[model samples]
Target: MDELDLKYALEAILFASGESVALQALARAIEKTPSETRELLRELMEDYDRGMRGLRIMQMENRYQMLTRNEYFPYIRNIVKATPASSLSQAALETLSIVAYRQPVTRADIEYIRGVQSSSSLDLLVDRGFVRIAGKLDAPGRPVTYETTPEFLKLMDITSISEMPKFEEFSGGIQLRLEEQPEENGQQ
Candidate 1:
């Protein structure tokens, strides 16, 4: 097909899927090389941006998705009557952070890092589709391992976990203080 036809084909595929399409899959669909297809996709993205269209194409790693621009969320929400998703609690957010950085981690590891049980927080993250069971570790009891999902990446507005800020960048500013407790025996 010609250039315009190829662009339309890519656009249609992205719109119909309503999800991220892999670069290889898109290339196969358009019968073009991966590099050529990537170039075409970039041009289409630019066209949308230049036209000030309500829709935008986002590239997440090797995949591409067509989505309504964030600026138009109010209008889309009004038409869809969508309810606002509940925000994650501090505990859940902490659990999610652990899973994101040390993925394929187990509940035991998460609890150890947080210094508390993380069952509820982990469950909440699983329910929200931000985290998933990757598999089980081959240790003694074969504990289940957890990993962050693509939905988590989308929520974070990041294409890859590598984009996350380095731990050292923020760790330097945080300080932890523990209070001493009185002994129950009352033996001065």
Candidate 2:
């Protein structure tokens, strides 16, 4: 299909689907190679961003979805059909932060660092779509490992995890003893 045709097809599919559309599915629908489809979709996404639209496309892993721009979230929330979501608890936020930084980590690993039973907090993060099971570790338990999703990056207002503030800098204040924390907590 031509570029304009492909763009319209994508727009129609995304808006009508009301969900993330897989890259492979989009490629098949457009009768294009996956790479070409990706490029076109990326261009489309950029166009939406640059066009001053109230909506934009978000790529999550290998799928894309149409999403309202962050600037419109408050207004959207004001008109939503359900009760507003409660804010994340401190423990949930802590667990999410740990997973975002020490990604592919296990519940055991998180509990070890946090010194608490983090099952509920971890579950809350996963249920909220901020965290997901990445893979199993090559350890004794072969534990299910966890990682932050693209949604997490989007909510954090960063394109990549590298843009997040150093985890050590944020947590070192508590990680170290008073004497060590003052001089050598996160300087490195």
Candidate 3:
């Protein structure tokens, strides 16, 4: 297709996709080689900039998503139906991180790391899309286990759970120290 046709095609795909679309996926959908698709996308992005449009194509991780310029968010928020404000608390985030990195884990296991009862926090994470019930463990009670969802990967901008950073990568923080604080003080 010609340049204008290619621009329209790219814009349609980007706007239609609610989630970030990988370049490979975009190329396949448009029947173009990856290099050709990349060139077309770059041109389209430049056109948006040159025209001073409020929307832009953004690369996050290995995929692309269309986003309105930050300066325009206030105006857009006024006109559009607002998405519900959803956020995980610090406690919920910690529980999510543990389950995300150590998938197919049990509640008791999560409580061990957190050093506190985590049933409520786990319920909250499950209520959100971040965590999911994986299966029953093979041990005694056959308790249910949990794992991170693709939604979790999308939120974290990661392609896979394996890409999550190792716990040692986070070991030096005050947060990490706090995990073992009760243990060090001879408390359960």
| Model 3 lowest lDDT segment of ten | 179-188
RMSD of 1: 9.0
- Of candidate 2, the 10-residue stretch with the lowest lDDT total is 179-188
lDDT (tens digit, per residue) of candidate 2 on 10-60: 888889988778899999988888998899888888889996789998886
lDDT of 1 by residue, 112-165 (tens): 989999999999999999999999999999999998877887887777767777
Off by over 4 Å in 1: 174-188
RMSD of candidates 1 onward, in order: 9.0, 4.8, 7.0
Model 1, TM vs. native: 0.81
lDDT scores for all predictions?
A: 0.85, 0.80, 0.76
For candidate 1, what is the lDDT?
Answer: 0.85
TM-score pick, better of 2 and 3: 2
Q: Judged by TM-score, which candidate is best? A: 1
